[model samples]
Target: MLQNTLEVSVVKNLDFIESGVHICVVANQVVPNLAPILDRNLKAKRVVLVHTADFLQKAKDLASAYSNYQVKTEFFKIQSAFDIVSLRKDMQRLFNFYAEQKPLINITGGTKIISLTMFEKAKEYELPVYYVNTDDSLSWLVPDVESVYHLEDRVKIKPFLTANGFEVVVNELPSSNKLLRQVLDDLIANIDGYKEAISQLNYYAYTASSSLKSVSLSENVEGLRKLVGLFAETGLMKIENNKLIFKDEDARFFANGGWLEEYLFHQIKQLGSKIPKIQDNLCAVEVCKKTNSVKNEIDNMLLCNNNLYLIECKTKRFSKDQSPEGGVSSAIYKLDTLMRELGGTFARGMIVSIFELSKADYARAKQYNIKIVSLSELKDIKRHLTSWLS
Candidate 1:
């Protein structure tokens, strides 16, 4: 019989006791079923078995089995519904019992509610909760536990004394790595299409601008409207208050400085002889100050040739740091006003940006026939001009 499998040895130890000796027994049995011992330990006290909604029937079955073992077990039903009221009520009842008897074995394996409720109640009563699972294929218990045993078909055990806050080690858990990789690969593949679309749109905008001999501000605005419309149709950009607002996800590539400058230069050079060329050292002056108050410190101005091409470059960065937008905008406004005051002697008006232009800005620039280039396409303009000069 199972009882004979154990060898029990009793020893009497007499320390400094006056007239009594304590007897201690060491038993080597088929992993001495602690269920019976634990039940006896809670003899006259309240022993509540907190169960989740999903495993309520299973817990009841386990309690019935324990009855045969002559252990007194009381079933405490805990609901695991998404409803907040029911969950709160269940927590209240569990906390009340925890304050009274302070259970030894708190099982939480079936549902999230069990873990959530037990986690709160365990802190109040300082109770030791054990996760009992029917699945033996994997060990659900956390490490640091003293010992574990298999009871019939169910996995049972008492964990080591854990602190109030314990974090689960998810790295060791089994997961679908292959599926995750496949999903990531598919996402990257789809993003390539957006990149290509933006490239085509940039090319079209640049080519259209370079083909113009000398455009007025009104004509420039019209051109921008056409470009913005194209972007909206192709879903690369959206129109908001005459401005091209990039969808958040696609904003990064559209704001690429290198690409914008290259496209701008390419289109400008394509203009050929339509744009007049003043002498190389003709003093190309850039007025970078705002229009309202003229900072007549002419020495601070960046000098170019008499064929001065004033460009206002705009862009937005993720940081709060000062971007080129404010400086560039202020510079353009002041220069334009200054040139107008000087009887339109300036060669040309231009606006360059690392960002897509808004409908209003685009229209404003077009109305002045201001040439625009993206930051990325800037290098291409110089290269195109070099070829023209060659």
Candidate 2:
């Protein structure tokens, strides 16, 4: 189930035959699962969607957008998707009505109960049964058709997110350049206690509404003055009346908000470029749920050879005695959950840390299947990243 490119290839092979009705199972995961049926070119005369009451309208609206194909889409609701008995009866009745067009049932969406019931009816009526197995490409369940198809660059970020559950999406990432890498390297080299320094700098700016209003760096705080002194050398800070002032708006924003994220974005984009044939690459993507209640941000993400990589960048020091909700522990949880929701089991997770980690923290990251890139590796960033991603 939920095959992206494999489904498209199967539809392409079935193009020679007369137009037939495609009965697609609709569940909450309609975008990626249903996209292969609707977006691709098929000799589908009409698409009959078997969906639950809540998502019935969404399916209809999605189908209506396909005016170029001139195919009709109808929605038949199942009062309760959990009720297998009623679902079978609806499928039987639809089969009787569209028996002449020879509809093909694609059991890639919906719950297991829906699929099993339809599959049983498919057997009883001796209708064609096909499934797209993302694990092993598209497979024929009933017809026993043995063929493997190769597809590339089929899944895009926007449609996949739109169908999954996101309502608001913004991804406008810039291309990687050597200048970014140089700046990041300079930050690490020129600054002492770089991670803690940036953390304190960020914390100071974060407490203010805007960087135009300067935050004072206490000379008594042991490392705060040194950090401010280093940043001042790079023109990121200005010393005025014994107070540390951000030189420009960019400095204020990055120092307070997403400096680490922006740094890793450029660094990873540069590393990913060295690899050949990456399907997609993006950074600093922000998305929100349907009601715009919860918003999730991805520092960097890339698709390669059917695997989606989710990366998180952190500039804070990890505490050995901190609670589970503490820095490193929470980051591990965030990366793992994002990978599971966005790319399922096949997706990968990584954490690129500007700070060093203890042995226990490294093991914790490993337990969550999160690869780590520590500050020491920044000198040979490309090599370390290549080995990890490869």
What are the TM-scores, per candidate, against the unseen true structure?
Answer: 0.24, 0.72
Q: Deviation in angstroms for 331 in model 1?
A: 87
How would you encode candidate 2's per-residue C-alpha lDDT over 44-96 as one tens digit per residue? Answer: 56778877878865575446433334667777677667787787788778667
Q: How close is candidate 1 to the true structure, as a TM-score?
A: 0.24
| lDDT at position 212, candidate 2 | 58
TM-score of 2: 0.72
Q: Looking at candidate 2, what is the lDDT of residue 146?
A: 53
The global Cα lDDT (0 to 1) of model 1 is 0.35
Clashes of 1: 35
Candidate 1: worst 10 consecutive residues by lDDT? Answer: 157-166
| Cα RMSD for candidates in order | 28.5, 6.2
Put down candidate 1 lDDT per residue, 203-309, tens digits, no spaces.
43333343321122232355445444544534444545434445443232333322233233323433434443312211112222222333331111111222234
